[model samples]
Target: MSDNQQPAKNHVTLLLLSVMLLGAALVFAVAADAPHTLVLTAAGLGLSFSRRTPLSRTTRSYVYAGVSVLAATVLQDQIFPVDTQRFYLIDGRYYAPAVIFLGIAITFFEQRDTTLTSVISLALIGTMIAGNSGATIVTNPRFPMTNGLLDYFHFFYGCVVAVQMLAMLAVLPHVDRRVRLPAPGRAWRWHRATVFWVSVFGVAGTVVGLRVAAIHYERLADRTFRDLFRVYMRRQSERMIFGYEVDLWRTVPPRTRADKTPVVRALAAQAPGYLRGRAFVRYGRGTWSSSDTGEHLPPTRPGGRYAYSVFRRALAGRTPSATPPPAPRPATIDLLPATAYPLGGLLAPGNAVEFELIADGLNNSNEGALVPREWDVAGGYSLALDDSIRDTAYQGPAEPPTEAERYLDIPGHIKEDVARVANTVFGATPPRPGTQGRLAQLSRFFEAGFTYELGVKFDPAGKDPILQFVEQRRGHCELFAATTVLLLRAQGIPARYVTGFVCGERPPSGTYWVARLEDAHAWTEAYVAEENRWVLVENTPASGFPTTDSASGVVSRAFDRLLVAWQNLLAQVKRGYVAEVIVALFLGLCRGLGRLLTHPLWGPVAVLSLGSAVWWLWQRRRRRRLAAADRLLVPTRTELQKTLGVLEKQARRFGVERQPCNTIRELARRLESAAQGPLRDALLELLREYETLRYQGTPPAVEAVAEFKAKVRRRLAAPG
Candidate 1:
């Protein structure tokens, strides 16, 4: 075929190819979570099938637009679960709109030359890359990254997409040249060797990259967090910018420790949990700060014994570090949700419970929300309690509380009505006086009237409304915890609010779903002396536990097991083992069928028979058409004489023609001598052949005549 004389490929062929690719993309989208694969595949397909343009170009451009939309949807779904201050999905609401614009912009130069096209292509790529990268980094500002590895993955992902785009663009020209149709009877064969090798290498490269990235992407963040922590701790800032705080790890001590009492030492021996942040005391209008007082230590000598029911909220869903069981366990560790603000102070149950707090930065100090775990103090020394700093005072043995200190240090605003309700719930007679009585009363009080619930409708009027709820005898976990802490504190017991998740849910495979936000809770802590330590007392009514089941439970578990099998089957199919086996079976069956269709002897006979059949049909059609045309066609002698007369008339009409005297042969010779001489060559050749055949009475072969007829008909059909 001539360089530009392509086969007649109309819009229909381009449409068919576009549909096939779009169908493939749809299948992928339905089966996989990542839309990028489908999107890039569609883009590649469009580039390959872009020969039938206007139609091909239009199809590709629109499909790209569709891909952009699908990708946006996938991205949106991926980001939906991460609750952050910024909109990570669209990376800013404008991101989707900007992408749409980029898609449209690419269409402007769809028909341009290579250089101009590349310019537009570069612009589109640049806008897409810069906009998306900016959106991600801007929206998720990494002020103090907990993991450096995660950042690296994020950065690498951008680079990979950019590289993939460039690679695809670089190969577009070669791909486009391959899909074009050829001239009649010259069907273009795609180079099987080239297509096969390129495809195999491309797929292998992709598989290797994805496998490597998957193994390492998630862990990068965690590793980086660890590395940066080590670096920040030892290195001084080369240049500190305004408002830039020191890295979180560098600011806090490596090992969190607390006042060392026997109880603290015992708890510490169990395990080293993240020491929840230290307690805060002074409160400014919108902010809360901690007191400068050091850790509290238990007192030595005792006048009156005291007991503290420290209620710790669970960090639901999170795995706990392995720790040994506590000695003389104070009571049941009632799990509460994170938001519940249990009343009465927060103190774990133990005669001399100690706290080892790894200070979480100052921003969240004493917001009364920290994960509370059994303390693991360094030494088996006694602790001295300091009223000013509730966290810790002295490092020694447990002590007794003075009567006035235990029962009369009521904050001025403890509503009398709230105290009355507390009296009604626990009674003036302490339940198991010093420790036992208080525990029993607390248990009895909660069991009688409260129910656990995931969410509590908070009252804006805080304490006053809580007091009213005490009279009502029913409230959510927060209300119960808040009321308990306040009442216990009012009655001379030190108490504080605590936030954490509740009990872990065990599933079949030794896996547990920790407390979720829905399990956020609160409870109370009261001081006692029987065990010579503070005891954690859960008083938030059991009725308040969330009623809904987790998605990771029974139903989901069964579905996931089934899903695993399906995935395995699909994996086999994608890897081609299943398809290859099927193909082999089909080929085995087809072996006999092929013999029937093309046995050595039969194949030659069948081909000859078909060719004879076609030749017969063509001869019949041509003979009929030639007979009709001949009836209309004058004899050659008459046509020559008429042509000579027309030339003579033209000479006479013009009155100047030297050609008027020329014979037919002379006129023909003169026409042949001019630059356009080839115009008469075909006729001359036809005349010579005709003269030889007719004068000699020689019969031309059917095939030769047929081909000659076709050529003559085609030549005569052209417009002059």
Candidate 2:
């Protein structure tokens, strides 16, 4: 590696290492959604290909041309790490092409620190690769992420960069000492010519990329790629410039993001019951108001002691059973953000008997309302619920309210319509005594034809909104609860509406249920005359009531994982982790891109196409300019003019040139004076042929001009 004599081998190794390093950063950048990968890629490619001479320069340039493209894929995990559009501003369509041109502009300097250039390029490339997928990517329950350290793609790249740095400690040994036509001057000219030709092909590549990208994204946007060519540029700008193509994502329908935003994080010994927020006693005009519940307010000084009273009243006059009751499930909940609702919620598990909030900072309203003092607080409210405490066969309240007009009344106007719904939902199935019977009935009604949609709107002046709900069978949680209350009340059953969150989402890796805005729900709670209890009734379709079922083994495993996650969080919080995390992310990006460029099919075709285009264009530019001497006026008017200009420019180089005379006779006199013998006779013959073709439009063989240029070059070089 320290041997300067091995330039060819060294260049090959550097190319491989450079591509690998760049590929890793690019992949990680895309995964992390860092947008600046575009700028770094263009600059890196431009700086790397600054070789001189037509053939070697173009070949070297092509080595870097298609390096920006590798593999085309849409990442499967629906995570987008880009928080802002700052990356897009820098990697704009205009900025990308400009960067390429500017990179070529950098090649205007020949004796550059290739080592420093590679280092800076890789460093910025590393930066654009940016942040880690977060620690979660490594330990996520999904195993695909950390497989084979594919996420560590640039380890090989880093090793090479380090080795090259060691060599840079030896840079002074490599400078050439030639005096006349010094190596630096020759290098300057060579570098200029190299970039000029690279620019030509770059422009062509840009035009072709743009045209193809437009056609593909516009006309073929909806269709399949059909071939590899179509997808080679997936997530990249048309080959014109290498930037992330935001619109090239596969057309998979996105998962609904409406409710993924979490509003609460609650931990439980098991999935806790529906956390109750508010309870409403009166129902009319399609609304449930939490007023006049006919119950005394519970005391609050002793934190959770007052809550047990609310539960005891519900369990009033209950009888104990022969079976042993299950232990109380304990849980804590925190409000993640301030919400429209007045309070967070009270934990209410199935058949909760003696409810107690171990933590305070919250208040309870007797009608099942638990209001939090602050939206986001360090301390969360904890409570216990006895899921196994059945209604225990209650036989109605000891002394029912004696008033003829109960304030907790359902409106009489909607009784007939609700009864009709009852007939349809129950279908002659005789009602059983306890709270479970009514709960089962309402559950069936919701499941029959109604859907759990959040978009169903209602008009206040319409013909009985509850009636309309039954007829149309479309409403949200509110309507579902109201309809259930009305239906239960129509059958002479006492029921009220309850609003709260249905916190039942238990992840495999978590001991908690996350509640989001979409989880805010409303349901019915009916007082069982025979059971003497207010039991929860889930009336919304698919909103099944909570159940307490968790094996000890599963709970233990989840607790262990939670502990590990907490420790990981602590590790990440330390200051030293910032650098390590940044490096890890860069490696991951490079690894991903490395996979793409190393693809068996896409990689080779890209390299070949780029090489061929550059090679052909360099040759063509050389032919047209006759650059061995210099380029003269470009003949666009006619064939005679084109041939004459070529001949005149070449003849002038040997100091025997003559041109621009209007008459053929006068031109002949001048050429005869400027030269003599074979050169003069040959020039006159060519002039006569040009005159013939200019006026007569008599087409001459295409070879006449080529044969003329060959003769002129050969004679001009004959020891003049």
Candidate 3:
């Protein structure tokens, strides 16, 4: 309504907007792993323009004291019990303390005094050191802590305090006198105080900027900021790129080739068969990707006899009989740490009748690949597939399903080459028109000519990798699988490229199959129009894939089992099951303690002993801080010296100087002689207050001290 009120309203609006921006940046930093620069810039700009009012010094001090009490209570296990098994929540415990200290520092900005500012600065610096130490102890187990670059815990708490301090300095009208015209003679004093604080903030900003730049440079040299943030946040799974991309591409050497990295272990009567991860329908010049944009199938319950019968008939290349058979046998699988992506579920060659997964988020893709919604450290699922009809011929309808079209996708660049190769291998017109005949002919072509070699490299920039494989007669499983899928598509058969792990080395006990990273294999699956099913067609030579005997060693197998157990433990921890167990154990212990304390005769003695011990501990800790108490008292003595100097300067203005050995009361009497009326009364009052505070153990209140100092200034300014 009024012109004077307009600027204040604008400042308030700017402050709200800045706070919102900073809050958004904080959320983004947490969720999206945003760059530190983005968060820092947002926070800095927000503080620069904000004009929110700060809490009064006394109110803020009370809040800080309350928070400190709460922290002490929680640390003592009186409020929140500390469970070592559930220690992951320890970082969250730092929040209340950080907020309290930051609130106190911001309140100090309202008072334009360098002494208070320095004290707040020192408090914040001390808090940073303690917070970082606690964080390091909780997050890492190793001792002799090394100061690493981009310490998220330190940076986060430090930023919170710094932002609040800057916001208070920027917004509080009392902090910067230039924002308003002051009274005559008082203008220079206010200007000097303003410059001093601004310079302090400027120096702080320069130091922080240099530290951030150093961190950024260090992170850039080793890895990206996103990766560093992931490590900091302990979200390692987010960095994993699941799907066919990593499996299909051979940019790096296979893990198995370098060293045996166990992926899965199966406990079954026979070999668990290939474990399919994902399927791709489209084939480009040198790449393969899924083109079937089909929605995931709804989760199904465990099927009984009827489902099994139907599945058996479908896989057998025959129409289902009206009568149903018995339920199929189940096979169990244990996914390992080396298996980076989710294994959807353990699948066999034929249709799965039932799946009992010991995990959640399982879904079946349109291309028949099983994918889980999230990554799991270790999980298991049992499924029963219709193995009886797996190798049978098709006997379904003539027309193919609409979904089959995507599986026939072939890039235009290699379409001609694919057709020519298919024509030469199986003849332009095959001996049989069915899917089985074409598959048999393709298998013979690979077996007779192509050689299996992991070392074979293909130049993607040149001709298509599949074409190179066909011409050179040498390549790995990926090239073989890609060529097979392309060849099937060329022959008017719908086929998709599949990436998974083949059944690897089986131990002497023969209880299970161990699938390692080296067991990662690729193949093709072609859809049969008659059977209304997709059949796996392996074209890669058997010699190229890992065999059951490749992995063997008593010590190695024992270590693998240990690793599997460790992985399972981690998975349980992630799922909160371990925390639940720990809490249950803790409650049981507390109940037992209550029973023990209720014993008739010893109960009173036990209680007394416990109380005495606690009291003794408290006293010991209090006495331990005696040296620190002496150090803290040094600042109060310095402040007294500063106050005496100010009083002497004011007396000089009145042209009155008592002897050096004169007491404060004698000086005050001399100053009173130089003055009269209210000025004389003020000098006597100020001297009496100072004498009581200095001589006695009791110090005057902050407000009382401020009032006495103001009286001295007013008296010096008045005309005698």
- The prediction achieving the highest lDDT against the true structure is 3
lDDT of 3 by residue, 1-720 (tens): 211121232444235334433433342233222234233434444553453443334666657745653443233222222222222323322332333234333432343444234434434443343333333333322221322412565566456556645654544443334346545477787786788698667858866986788777985755775677668555535433335553334543534444465566766666666767667766665767664433343444333111101111122234454345344434434334455533434444435544443333444555555554432333344455554444311212234533446667788887888889888878986366578787898999989888887666667567877777788898788888888888888888887777777775787656567776677778777776665566678888878876778466888777766765676554444334445555668889998778868989778887999899999998887665543344554444435546767667656767778564588888887887685665556556766777776566665556666676676677656724
State the C-alpha lDDT per candidate. Answer: 0.38, 0.47, 0.55
Query: What TM-score quantifies how close candidate 2 is to the native fold?
Result: 0.35
* Model 2 lDDT tens row, 161-191: 3443333333323333243333557778787
Write candidate 1's Cα lDDT for 1-720 as tens digits: 212223433333333333433333332222222244346445644553564433234577667756665544433333321222233213323333233333333333233344234433443443343323222333222222313323453444434444443444444433334346455342323454555567657755775677678677869867986898678644433311111111111111211122100011111112111112222222222122343332223322211111111222211111222444333322222111111222112222222233222111112122222232222111111211222222211111123432324222434464566577667756766542544565576568767756543223434455554554565565565456556656665555655433333423333543222233344344444444433333344676545653223336577667644543454343333223344565567788788657755888887876788789999999998767545544543354334333334334433332323342344454445445544333345544543443443234344455544555555545434413
Clashes of 3: 2
Backbone clash count, each prediction separately = 89, 11, 2
C-alpha RMSD values across all candidates: 24.5, 25.0, 19.9
User: At residue 480, what lDDT does model 2 achieve?
Assistant: 71
Report how far off residue 205 is in candidate 2 (Å).
Answer: 64
- Model 3 bad stretches (over 4 Å): 1-242, 246-257, 291-293, 296-329, 339-363, 379-399, 430-433, 459-461, 509-511, 568-720
Candidate with maximal TM-score = 3
Native RMSD of candidate 3 (Å): 19.9
Candidates 1 and 2: which is better by TM-score? Answer: 2
- Screening candidate 3 with a backbone cut-off below 3 angstroms (N, C-alpha, C), the clashing residue pairs are 396-530, 505-548
lDDT value, residue 334 of candidate 2: 29
